[model samples]
Target: MKLFYSPFHTFVHKVLVTAHECGHWERLTRVATFPFKNNQGEDCGDTYDISAINPLDKVPTLVTDTGQPVFGSQAICEYLDATSRARRMYPAPGPKRWDALSRLSLCDTIFESTVQMVMEQWKPQDQWNMGLFTWLWPKFNAGLDSLERGAERGWDDFDVGHASMLHAISYLGFRAEFYEAKDPVYPHYNWREGRPALAAWFDTAIQRPSVASHYNQPFTSDSSAEACQAAVRECIALRAAHGQ
Candidate 1:
């Protein structure tokens, strides 16, 4: 399989966590995409060559050995669950499944809101929109509060939902400086305060091998991308050495 992603893309990292948790981290070729800007520093093409497969031209796009394309974190992560024989995160239809899916929705909602805010920040000050903060900012905080309240259930097993939450929370701290910038509309609250259960849960869960491997490095162009390339290279070498 071949996957196109940007290390700073929180959504893309969800797929990475899914792959790692499924014990197939070394099975795919990880390709880095310049989603923001190319070497020229010009505005990026919304649909780089990846657009050929995904019209959105988004990262976290995957192409399986059979040449089937899977785009978006949900499709990619669920695809991994369907194809792999390892423990499945998508529990068989039950209350647990519904609960997990609900959490996934809340977490991804927060992720999307943050993506919008960050993208808006990329624009000049004059073009800023007040509605984003008026509407989206509160919701993002509410979602985090929801997760913190459910800390016990949120980080229980590191399933697909857990992967979603992990990616979301990690990015908040990872991009702390950006989020903390002088944007009155943007939120700069302490996420760990008054949430000992969730804080403790994340403190431990973030150390898992899947997370520590990809996210431990600075999430910059050279650092994170280089780390991902190295992981893929190592995975390939291991597979080759084992004659698989």
Candidate 2:
């Protein structure tokens, strides 16, 4: 399969982490796509016109060997788990599978909310809406608190769900300052301050070769998805040079 990959995109990072967990990271052919200014004067990243493969023109699109195109991050992660030589990320049909799926959904939802809220910050002052601030941010915090509680249960064993949460936490840290979030809600958004268990787990999660090697872009206010695409391309070159 070929993966339209990005290094700083939380969703793409999520699927990459899942692929590594399934022990099949090397199977994918990575394609780099940077965001560009569109006629609408908005930031758009579908330089590949991914819409030809995925009507949504989104990143992390996977074109399977059978010539089937799969878009969206969760769908790609599930696909990776399903086709992997080892059935490690997703459990077989059963209650355990249901539980894992639910956890995966929660992590993805949190990650999605953060992305939405952060994107909203990109609009001009006149276009910004306080209603989103009142609604979306609270939802994001609820997800964080939910994960905090889940962390109490421990997150050492790497699974798709664990990868999900780790990406959410790390992505928030990576992009927090880029938004206009203020105290109490974001307030530097030091997610580790009150969440001990999650913090401890993150300490380990970030060290994983899969996490560390695939994602190492220091937080930058590039304000364009192109930076993410560049980071992924750079990582690919580095990995190839090292024979990884």
Candidate 3:
């Protein structure tokens, strides 16, 4: 199986945690892709493009050993859980399942919206979308608060929602610490501030073997665009060979 994704390991990736927890980590061949770089401009070339395998040409795309492509973090995570060789991240259908899914939805939104803010900040400061930051900050505040409440109540075990929470919070921290642009509303934003329960939960969660395996760890293998395209071609050939 090939897992084509962004090489950035500055934050925990929910798909990676799911794969590791589900015992598919060793079975996967990680492929570094930079779809956003490709989108910057056509003159920059499409060397990183994986549109041949994935229509959206996005990262976090997983090609199964049988050559079936699964995109979207949530879909890929669910697939991993369904075929889990070890443990399942998703709970069986029940209230626990619904709650986990709900939290997953919430944190994934935070992660995606935070990505949007990062992209918007990439533009000239004058061109930065103040309105976007204004609109999103309140949602971010509310979302973290919701997570805090959940953390305070606690869970019996680590689940998909916990993985997503790691993904969202880690990236949120990364943006504030690494990105140069200052948010208009909360220039010195600190997610940890006043969210003691969430912070404690995050500290403990990061130590989990699944999250520890990739979080904050540098990608050591070949991460070039050429390598990414090669992996994409391999998946295409595999699918063709199987007449899929």
Candidate 4:
């Protein structure tokens, strides 16, 4: 299988965690893809494009051994869980499943909204959308509060929801540290403030083998577009051979 995704290890990736938890990490061929470079017109040319397999040309796209393409992160993670050789990230249908899915939905929204905020900050201060920040800040606060409550309640085992929470929370910190400009609404925002339970849960969760596998680690594999394209071609051939 081939996974085309942005090689940003500063933040946790739920897909990577799910892959490791499902025991499919070693079997995956990681292809570093930066879809943002294309949007930024960063002179990367067409090297990072994977639109052939994925119409959206988004990252975290997985091409299975049978050459089937899975795009959305949730879909890819669930795919990994469904085909697990080790532990499962999803629980069977029940109240536990519903709670896990609810958390997953909430955390994923936070992660995407945070990405939107990051993108808006890419513009000059004068051009930044204050309304976007205003609209989103309250949502973020409420969402984090919800997560804190959930964390206080805790769970019996690590699930897809916890992986997503790590993904969202780590990126929240990364945005603060990585950018030079401060967020207008929460310049020195600290998510851990008054959210001790959530912070505690995060601290312990990061130690899991799934999270530790790629968190804070540098991408040492081939990151060139040529390598990524080569893998894409291989998948295309596989698809043709399988008549898919």
Candidate 5:
């Protein structure tokens, strides 16, 4: 199997981590792609033809040995668990599978919301929509709070559901800190700090070679102070233009 991915993307990291846990990481060939560029002219790392593999032009697109294409991290992981000799990451088709799917959906929601928040802040002032952030952030926090409560109730095991959740939490900690810092009132903003089990899970997840590779590469730093300052200026300019 050939795994086409951008090393700088958290979504790609999620897929790689799952493959590692499933013991299929070494069996796969890593195809690098240029998903992000730094200040220099050189591509950061991981070059691929996203459009060729998947029309979505997204990272973490997996190509099976039979030439089947599996896009999306969740779908790729599901495919791996289904076809591999490794222990099923997801349970058999039954109540357990349904539960795992639901949790995975929750994790996807959190990831999507985080991406939305980042785009809203970083996009040009004319393209910005403060209303979207105002509306979505509260719901995002509510979802995070629910996940926190679930973890508190002892759902932090390595089941398919919590594996996705662990990936989400670790991704947020690494990539979405700017958004979280901007909105500290988020319900589960500090959830990981006190949740030792979840924290440990995240710790282990981030240490995998796949995850470490992503962090070790150079990419545009959206969470940097300069980026935050630029976002703030853009927001203020937008507000002023609207006579707010």
Candidate 6:
């Protein structure tokens, strides 16, 4: 199996991390593709002819040995879980499976909103649209709040579903301080507290060789300060374009 992905993407990272945790990394060939690039010239593309296989040109598209194509992180993850005989990532069919599916759906929704937010800020200021942010931020917060409430119910024994949510939340923190700042007021503010089981689980997952490998240096060799400045400039330019 060939797993084609762009390391710069958090969604792709999530899938890769899960695959690694499920013990399928060894049987898989990692194909690095560039789907997102920065001003500094980081390029991402697809390995297979995307148009022929996937109607939508996207990264993280997996091609099985039988010439089957699977797209989307969630779908690909499900495929990985189904094709592997190792311990199942998702629970067997029943309430547990539904529960996991629901959480996975939530992860997809929140991640989609987050990506839109990033794109909204990537454009020139004159082309920016505050309305988009206005519309999405509240939805994003609502999703986070929902996750917080779910976490409060005890995600320590997080099945595959809950694990995906945790990864999404942590990825937001790792990528954006804005979300981190808002986490204090989030519904389950102390979700990580008194949850040694979950904490240990996350600790182990994050440090796994596959997961750790995803933390490769940023696409750009620019200094941290420079990156921040560039991001700020982009945001400001975007806002200015939108007259926000």
Candidate 6 has an lDDT of 0.59
What C-alpha lDDT values do all the predictions have?
0.71, 0.67, 0.89, 0.90, 0.61, 0.59
Pairs with backbone N, CA or C atoms under 3 Å apart (clashes), candidate 4: none
Cα TM-score of candidate 2: 0.78
Task: Please give the lDDT score at residue 211 for candidate 5.
Answer: 59
Candidate structures ordered by lDDT, highest first = 4, 3, 1, 2, 5, 6
- State the displacement of the C-alpha of residue 126, model 6, in Å, after optimal TM-score superposition: 3.5
TM-score of 4: 0.96
**Best lDDT goes to which candidate?**
4
Score residue 71 of candidate 3 by CA lDDT.
94
Candidate 5 residue lDDT tens string, 102-170 = 888888777767776676667665676767767876775576667656655655345566666766666
- Kindly report which residue stretches of model 1 are placed more than 4 angstroms away from their true locations once superposed: 9-12, 38-48, 152-156, 218-244
Clash count for candidate 2 is 1
TM-score of 6: 0.67
Clashing pairs in 3: none
lDDT (Cα) of model 3: 0.89
Q: Which lDDT tens digits does candidate 4 get at residues 54-140?
A: 999898899999999999999999899999999999999999999889889989999999999898888888999899989988998
| Candidate 4 error regions (>4 Å) | 39-42
TM-score of each: 0.81, 0.78, 0.96, 0.96, 0.69, 0.67
